[model samples]
Target: MNAHHPPGQTAPQDRPARLTVGVVGAGRVGPVLAASLALAGHRPVAVSAVSDASLRRAAEILPGVPVVPPAEVLARAELVLLTVPDDVLPGLVAGLAETGAVRPGRILVHTSGRHGAAVLDPATRAGALPLALHPAMTFTGTSVDVQRLAGCSFGVTAPEELRLAAEALVIEMGGEPEWIDESARPLYHAALAIGANHLVTLVAQAMELLGTAGVAHPARMLGPLLGAALDNALRSGDAALTGPVARGDAGTVAAHVAQLRAHAPQAVAGYLAMARTTADRALASGLLKPGLAEDLLGVLSDTANAASATDPADASEGPEATDDGADGGDL
Candidate 1:
């Protein structure tokens, strides 16, 4: 590993210099990132944690790293990671810059997917190098996240002059950096939120629905099915869709709606919404026959109208197998 380069200078792209790293919000993401950087020979010198969970994570993930205030963290480290929530990032950057804590030639990297390098303009004007390097993986605030970083993709944004530095930092943490244009940061984050965040909600709902339907081991039962479905979806995109909605089986879809409304009223809205989307995509792809879509769409609209008429509890899961498909398979 390359030793720390002098301040205001960068090491060669192929040789990432080991620098003193500090974490400004020791949340689920901060400690894990610092830990990953530590593995790459970067020294974690200080961390800031306000909450019990964050404090614990900081200690557990970066033992011996002094717990300090944010300003102190900036004072002691060459590379400071701002891993606060997206909503809190702008204010934090502004506050730090206003206090004159952001030193010239210091590296300020934020892990907010919703933002890009522009969010650090305050710090940038203070002469700190800015990078938005968002790792596209869920974290558990534990050592497990260190392993998860291997091969993970990061949405990276930086000034053209600092592109290589941003990429090198991500690579040192064992992540692949995908360049994100500053203007497209919000949409890029939205796509990740739709795919990863909403997926957890969908899976949790599925498990809950299964449990309510008398399945003793919901997770165990659904694990393989969901796994296979995910794999297929990743490989084939819209073509991987193979449920009642995609098949345009109005009967099965209507049955699912009725059952969800009766048994899991909360799931009715999500089901109808996803079904409508699936139907639309299916028709667009010519996978759903227009003649059959009329009935499928009718059921969705009717169910949505009914669901909106009454208040429903939050519920789980998606289209369950009601009837056999033409191939004698269930959703």
Candidate 2:
């Protein structure tokens, strides 16, 4: 339970330093943030939750907090957390400002990585101090999210004058603040999407392929291998490139393409794409000899053109695809 005080009195632990916090959108991110702030001596005065899940989450994470309307939330909170979706953010800020819900001197912070403080221009113009503090970690919308904040990086963007305040709030939530230029917010978000979001898709596809290959406990089978591969990639980068493509083994590459087309036809396209990309990187890094790459490139081209590389026996090789092979190295 939060330390309660009489009307207008701040939490005694921090006295005037304690803020009356309000959550505008009680989604997975909002309630978890509110709970974290409460731990940092802030008072969660009110929260706005419309859906059953949001209501339940708020109740679970922020017990005893009042569920109020947006305007009422703003009215009660000195520090307002706007944790709505990126698309809904602009309208929410505009509406709050237009409805006179934006109180001057109040802190208006949002958690959208795609947007900086500019999305909260309406609220800013209304005298609210705008801040964009987006946590870099994924959220479960549960209490787990609060713990995840520890040492997590927060992409923080704010007006120059309010930079200190923005970073301070992020620190209070147990996050390390990484200052981001307003203009770079979109690109920063895109980089994270490419790394984190696409990674999830890639892992799901790998699991599906393993299951199709008759592998039981695919996750258990993959866990250690994937862990080591990820660690090696992080530590060694392109130098860590292995497998047939890196060694310029056209025969092994052809074998993989044919096997995928025959067993997991849907995986053929992705296989070709990644193999081609990996080959390109390997060649660029001198891991693949240009003279030895012709056969591999030719096989890829033939499979792509045919769109039906069904025969593993038909997969051809170059002189380099000798007994030495890619040292039977498969990733």
Ten residues in sequence with the least summed lDDT for candidate 1:
322-331
Task: Report RMSD (Å) for each prediction in the order shown.
Answer: 9.0, 10.8
Model 1 — TM-score against the truth? Answer: 0.89
Q: What TM-score do all the candidates reach, one by one?
A: 0.89, 0.84
Scored by lDDT, model 1 comes in at 0.86
Query: What lDDT would each prediction earn against the true structure?
Result: 0.86, 0.84
Q: How well does candidate 2 match the true structure, expressed as C-alpha RMSD?
A: 10.8
lDDT of 2 by residue, 1-331 (tens): 2357676665545655789999988876888888998888889999998877778888999999999999999999999999887777888999989999888999998989889999999999999999998888877777987998999999999999999998988898999999999999999988888777777778888999899889998899989988988899899999998888999999998988888878888778778888888888999999999987878889888988877544444446645522211010000
How does candidate 2 score on lDDT? 0.84
Candidate 2 residue spans exceeding 4 A from truth = 1-12, 307-331
